[model samples]
Target: MTVDSRIIYGSWNLEEPTTPTRSRLFCLEPIGLGTAYVESLTGYVARLSETHYVETGMLILTQIGPLMKEGYTFDGRAGGIDKLYGRYTRAFNGASNWTSALISALEHLTLRHDLKFLSVLPWVEVIPLRYLLRPSRAWCPVCYQEWKDAGKQIYEPLLWFFDAIKICSNHHYPLCTKCPYCQKENRPLDWYSRPGYCSKCKEWLGTNQNSIQTDLGEPLKSDLNWQLWASENIGSLLATAPSLVCSPSKATISMAIAAYVEGTSEGNVSSFANKVGIEDQQIHRHIKGKTFPSLKTLLQLCKHLEVTLLKFLTEEPTVEDLARASARLPQLKNSTKRESFVIRHNQSSIELALKEALLENPPPSVTELSKRLGYASSGPLYYHASSLSYALAEKHLDYERVRRFEKMRSILESTLQKEECPPPSMQDVARQEGFSVQLLTTTFPELSRAISDRHKEYRQMLKTVRIEKLRQEVKEVAFQLNKQGIEPTRTNVSNCLSKPKSIVMQAAIEALQEVRHQLGWEG
Candidate 1:
């Protein structure tokens, strides 16, 4: 069969469909200026389908080659092709790792070249880990809103395809995996799926206020941040997929693991695997260069070690980096659930330390001691060294009682010496100081009686001074009004004094009225 070069080029869709002097054929240069990343596989398919006036993704996919309508799952897995919807770059055909079927699809269907489809999908050529691609779909509501507002073409970013990416660093909020209206999960490839909207309900995929909630407690927050950290780092790596010259090797990962575990239990494969939430044999194989870890496992291992994937894969960890990774040993150990050995070590260390401290002349209280020793709870001290711990607690209680009595005595002396008014009642003073009234009375009965007697005297003194003050204010207001050639009427006095007529002090108003009558200004 003698094939013409033009026909060969046409079959691969590498040549322009129609070479006109002015206008070029429909070569879908990514809907947006997607340089390094065009759009997700689902998004790219949808755009092409829309352009071809097709209703389903399967129709567009089948147009390219022998793709089964049911087999186009879009879950980044191998189906009829080696990587039908996966992140693999090379299309292996039992012999070579070159001809990518996805690139071929873009070429044939869109009449575009493979290089034109670089950012369109997470090709294994770009991302070596297909396991990082999520089975379901995720979207940032804020990113969608920003795109819509900016009138940019709506497309799913390749970053959202990663299962590790949950939080949107740009929005500082988590991505929505489920639809708010339909309450159904979004899938990568569906029959009538559209980007930036729910397939079932056709609702906009923009996140709402309700989606940014965290059901996990504070203890799990570190884990959440760790996941976010992974998402951010991986997203950054994917952003530079076009310029990525080197893919990470097994030896690079082995070196990072060795550096991370140099001075810790992680040096042991069993311990490292346990901490990384992977099987020991699997970790050992990766370490020995017998196998490579899946993208998810590698991410977990990096997250556990507090090291970035890019740095670990690219360069050897520095001494400072190693020191920092080692420092995380204590924090990481504290953050996780402890084994029997860790618990025993902590208990014994805490007991011995507390016993040594108890021998000091001025012993510390249990709460203060707990803080100083970095113990989250003092229960261990009480459980392990009950006699010494309890004795310390009892001694502190006695000291606290004496201190309270002394504070009460000072308060009583200050109150009695106050001559502006009489002393307040014991209950009022106790309330002011945030002390229990019963506790104060029981501790200082004599002082309590003195406060009560002084409170009565203070009330009488306040009554006399209040009346005198009111009379003086009324006289002053009247005198000023008369000087201004205004009658010292009740309304005038109230207004001049800046007092509301309704809330004018009754005593002051009455006094003004009496003075007005005496001054013949009662009209």
Candidate 2:
């Protein structure tokens, strides 16, 4: 069952016939598509190296060969096997599904006429072409009669060709009747039979739990585990005067102060208001940078300025989410008139260079370099300029905003060193972290949003753990939640731990440590 490509005829073998005398690209009955592949492989060469072995091995897997031999789909009396058309990258070490997809795509491309045409549709074409064809086979008279005459199981003759094969009977249930390989000796391997015997070899499923995430990556962490969003730029932003990000309601005030610094006269302030979208009178009232703008309106202004949506986004997305989102991008429309569609990617070099040039310009403010990007306004535009800087920077990828625990990090480091005072309030932690006291009560919308998610995740975790017991007996479960300063109420606990997202777990640990000090817990 080891796949050795050089031992097989390989690409050339797949192309030219083995012999002019027996030369024809056709499937014969009884021999099964699996047999044809085995013939092609064994007749190609004695053996090959590991790299070619996996590469060529993949080329064979996608076709459903053994099933093809027994007539699961294609060329059989009972046909309809799935045809694989495209490939997904394969893991050479193992991962039969991925290898199968890769091989299927390569073979189909090689066989199909003008497959080059599909290359133009790279995004769509990349999807694995699963369910393309059924297995079909050719049987020689000798292979057929000897198979029938062996007095083996009716399905035994295919032993010469396939590995993971099962012969489905033409019955109402349509289940596999027997193993094509062993014929009369054994029943075919069951597909989903885990921790059970293989239908062909009657052994365990690969003898490994390749069913989990950590196992897929040999280095474990290298498999893109949800990474911590501790970017260098995040440190820079957090270091800025905390006053830079006050309550959202005070955004108009901040903008007014920024305008004042720009020397916008009172009369000119009205003009600035009209340029963005807001009341001129409101701007005059908040000119001191004390009042905030509405979170929704601030986002709208930022978007119109062509800024990174990070102004509105937080809670770093996980690797799984990113993968899912990226996968969907290939399948969706590229652009829309209202907003650039996520699918519409691949920026032009010229346009990217233009953005870089603008960012590198002195004073780098939106209005200062308006001509660089061809914009008319300067007010409420500097944010967009910063966004352009991120977009043009190759190493930096601007995605969902990630929350930086400036305060919790300090507190944890201090507390871990056993130097902190006892029982700090949640507000104390926020204040220590440079957030306002209103943060816990949802006053600071961002902090509140994060807290709400925490509550949900906490509750969910508690729900999954069934600890129905009297108060005294509930020590184990109650003690566990209490260690983190969490009440054991089904509602509160469930709400706190409801998310089950790894990010939530990480954040909650930090948040609860702050609570632990407040609860006066030494442990």
Give per-model TM-scores.
0.46, 0.18
Cα lDDT of model 1 overall? 0.58
lDDT of each: 0.58, 0.30
Tens digits of per-residue lDDT for model 2 on 1-523?
A: 7788668553544565565333121222221222211212211110111113432223233333432121112223121112322222112111132332322333333342211111111111111222211122212222223434565322222212221222111111111233344442221111211111233454322111132122223432342221111111112222221223332222222432333312222124444455455665555444433244433343344333333223322212233433332343223232122211111212253345446654562324323333344332222232223244333321221111122344444443443344333334343455566643332333344544444344445545454342222222333333577877776544344354423222123334444444445445535
Top-TM-score candidate index: 1
Worst 10 residues of 2 by lDDT: 118-127
Give the runs in model 1 whose Cα sits over 4 Å from its true position. 1-25, 31-38, 58-62, 66-99, 111-131, 207-223, 262-280, 318-324, 327-523
- Write model 1 residue lDDT over 83-188, tens digit each, in one string: 3434332122101122234444556555665332333233332234445556567888878877887887887766676666666756556677889898998666
**Model 1 clash tally?**
9
Q: Which stretches of candidate 2 lie over 4 Å from their true place?
A: 1-269, 272-291, 295-408, 423-427, 436-523
